[model samples]
Target chain A: MKSAAMSEAAPATTSLPYTDTKPAGHADFYFAINATFRFILRHRGEEALRSCWRDIGGSYYRPVSKQWTEQGMHGVAEYWRAFFKAEPGAEVEVVESADEVRLEVARCPAIHHLRTHGREIVPQFCQHCYFVNEAIASPAGLTARVCGGNGTCTQRFIKRTVEAEAQNLEDIATAS
Target chain B: MIGCYDFCGHYEWTFEWLRQQGGHELVRAYWDEAIHQDSQLHASQLIGEKGIEGMKEYWGPTLADEGAVYERTVTEDVFRIDMHECPSKGFLLRNGLHQYADYCDHCMGWIGPLMQKAGFVIDHEHNHCGQCWWEMRRIDDASPASAPGTLAGTSDVRLRPGWKSPATDHYERATDPDDKT
Candidate 1:
């Protein structure tokens, strides 16, 4: 229900790395993201698909990394809070602490929209979170770990100094 | 990860990425196979089954949802859209994100194939500044696109001041992105 005018009227006090005129994005774009993943997976192997995700995380999201590098975990929490606010149908809570930022996604907008429309989701869809987030965090001296997925999940952005195991692809559920 | 708030930014970046991965053929195939066949399957189904009515039904809510400023004109034989402010292109332009050459072509890249499959042809033009006009007709209609002000009257995008600034890419009954004149 958030309209472009509302976003424009709000004070420029947001943590989003990029700015858009709209308050919430057009939800239909989820279709394109899902389609893009499917296209890459079909044409290229899983590794290449992962590379695409990683490349995008490092390239397209460099501004986010820069912000996180400058502001630390507080920036991470702020970014996620602003990000989900602009994604329609997303229900998420971003909790921040001294050491890390955690995002509890109650309803993932992309997965929800794709499933609602009966679109076939790529099984490795959730893995993009690991690859892309890791790429983004690595540059900011942080790391991301995602556990559950397919609708709900816990994503944590923590300092690189914290001793945590590498992400297990199995931890992320296959989206339907 | 890749949020939809800046989908147009990364979406344009992905075009250059895909082009580097394979070539222009890959980019074209991605538009046809992924976009037209996959992401826009609903659009394809609608237009294929209902034709011009489908275009109206689809674009009505879709454009409104995207917050586009435009007018839609429908005749029995043709459907025309005069875009005064394209939400997608406007977003990219506002954000100053231009990663690919002729980002406007992505529209024709996907919509052209869709119209072709739906047995229609397009007479279109875009100024790359978020202003464009499209006229869709049955392939057999054989009539050329109407002159500016003839179809949509003064609301015609082509008649708008600065509509031809910089340059405009025109397509005559084209159903392919490469058919630009």
Candidate 2:
């Protein structure tokens, strides 16, 4: 975790868009995230949960969208690099190039922690990566596609001008 | 992805989103159903089976993991906590994220129902400045919350000069977040 002062001193200089006092976030919060998804799906429906994801990506992450818009692929790469670094137990490799950024998730910290603690994960858990990331990327003239899940996945963020197929929800595996 | 690194930021934002989707009732339901019943089931099981001991078992490692600066006091009759610096609220404050109204109430929103299910009542107060105290007693105890310094001695959060704020919300023998004064 980066300090608030550090983030303030040079917002663009830091890899993470937001900073916290701790080096890494407490993994237990993953429980709440899964539970929140479960509650919305049960009480409202699948659409409502997806809307929640979009709202978070679009509104809550507006700063990130702004950064991605201003700095392009570099901003996306920096953000993911810092993001995975602050997620405890995450084993991710962020590869950035001129046109896109790809995240190779070897072990997802949230899934690992929830599974280790015997928490029942939402089946559509991996879809959140596409919905939320797409919402964030769209505003920056980019798009996100995710494939595989449960324990590992490949996430790619590419410029909207690049010809690419839309993400198929089926391609994202159901989390056990 | 909704990363946990800034969970509180999005968590608070989600509260407002739920309120807009359904109303305050939906937000309340989310806390009881999602948080107390599902997310924190371990806490429920522990406190339900062991009472005060369960609170210690649950909060000790939990608070430490969240990087909270606080103190806990326990006795045969009650379990008390003095939160000098709440990590959750502090994060929102530090990052200037305030999407929900009275984000502090979220604690009671879930914990109150959990404690009620376990046959206990809560006496709690938060100043919205990351300073608060909690005293939990059996449903039949009826003892009011201890005065500053009585329960946690020098660690009493109420004794802090900044503990009193105009935005302070207080509760006494309550099991509902709406029961605050």
Candidate 3:
């Protein structure tokens, strides 16, 4: 009988990956939630990085700004180069093994919203969404369970290793 | 693919323990009330340039007094750590000092005090799902749709319309060989 910001807009047929209870009646809930989730999943690192860029590109940030851009993104791409190095300025390592799913997070900016008007239901949205893979490291990942208020996740990020395409941030930064 | 599976496997072992333990804690089940109440707690509701009085009423010392994991995220300015539930990309650790952007120029909003008292911050992960793990090698094994290019399939993308910033439109006029300026 609990109502959430999206519950009213979510449909009864759609089941939350998080909870057992069906929603009351919002039809768009399924679409919104799924869209937001998939969006985060697809653009996880890229989106988080872009948040800081947006603040910089806009007039919203300055020397003393307390924005995510100001507090985070201190070293920029250079931080990751040192972080991923075996011993600073070393050769790039391949993520050949699953055990080493480690990556350092630098300058993460994430903001997503879930909104609903009378009949319209909005899905959850944020900078990025972790995957079922991410859950593997945590207990929730272990059992595929949902914790917290009604199984809704809080936005967060963790770093991991992945190969770079021909063009990438670190490559661009290191070029000069 | 077991390697990828292991790489993608998610597991959390702590927040449950804390959530289960009986202690002096403030855990909200449904945050709708907070959302509704804060709407009226608008920027103009208070008097003065910065509303220091309202701010004092809003924020207090952070739960830094409590025993917990905390970090000052450089990019996000998210300085709190989750005690247990590490869900993934969406499961972020945030004092979420940035959530109160509506009123305060520097997170001087009520959310700041709220973050302070809560001690550790775990965001509601507005990101609906994880990222797209798809790679395209062939297009339908032939042509048609694949000729121009393939579309990159994304993961859950609920809160995403205004997500990307549009480029500025300050294009200069075309130059003509015969035209004299």
Best by lDDT: 2
User: Which candidate should be chosen as best, given TM-score against the real structure?
Assistant: 1
Please report how far candidate 3 places residue B178 from its true position, in Å.
84
Can you give the lDDT of residue B105 in candidate 2? 85
Off by over 4 Å in 3: A1-125, A131-133, A136-176, B1-23, B28-181
In model 2, the runs with Cα more than 4 Å from the true position are A1-13
Candidate 2 TM-score for chain A? 0.91
Evaluation by lDDT, superior candidate among 2 and 3: 2
Q: Which lDDT values do the candidates have, in the order given?
A: 0.89, 0.90, 0.21
TM-score (C-alpha) between model 3 and the true structure = 0.17
For residues B1-181, what per-residue lDDT tens digits would candidate 1 score against the true structure? Answer: 6778778899999999999899888899889888999998999999999999999999888887787878888999999999998878988888788777878889899999999999999999999999999999999999999999999987898888889977789999999999988
lDDT of 3 by residue, A1-176 (tens): 11122222223332111111112212222222333223323434345324422322222112112222222323222222322221211223222122222232231111111232221221222211222222322322111111111112222222323532221222111100
Better candidate by TM-score, 1 or 2? 1
lDDT of 2 by residue, A1-176 (tens): 10121222223345665667777788989999999999999989999999999989999898999999999999999899889888999999999999889999999999999999999999999899999999999999999999999989999999897467888999999999
Ranking by lDDT: 2, 1, 3
Order of all candidates by DockQ, from best down to worst?
1, 2, 3
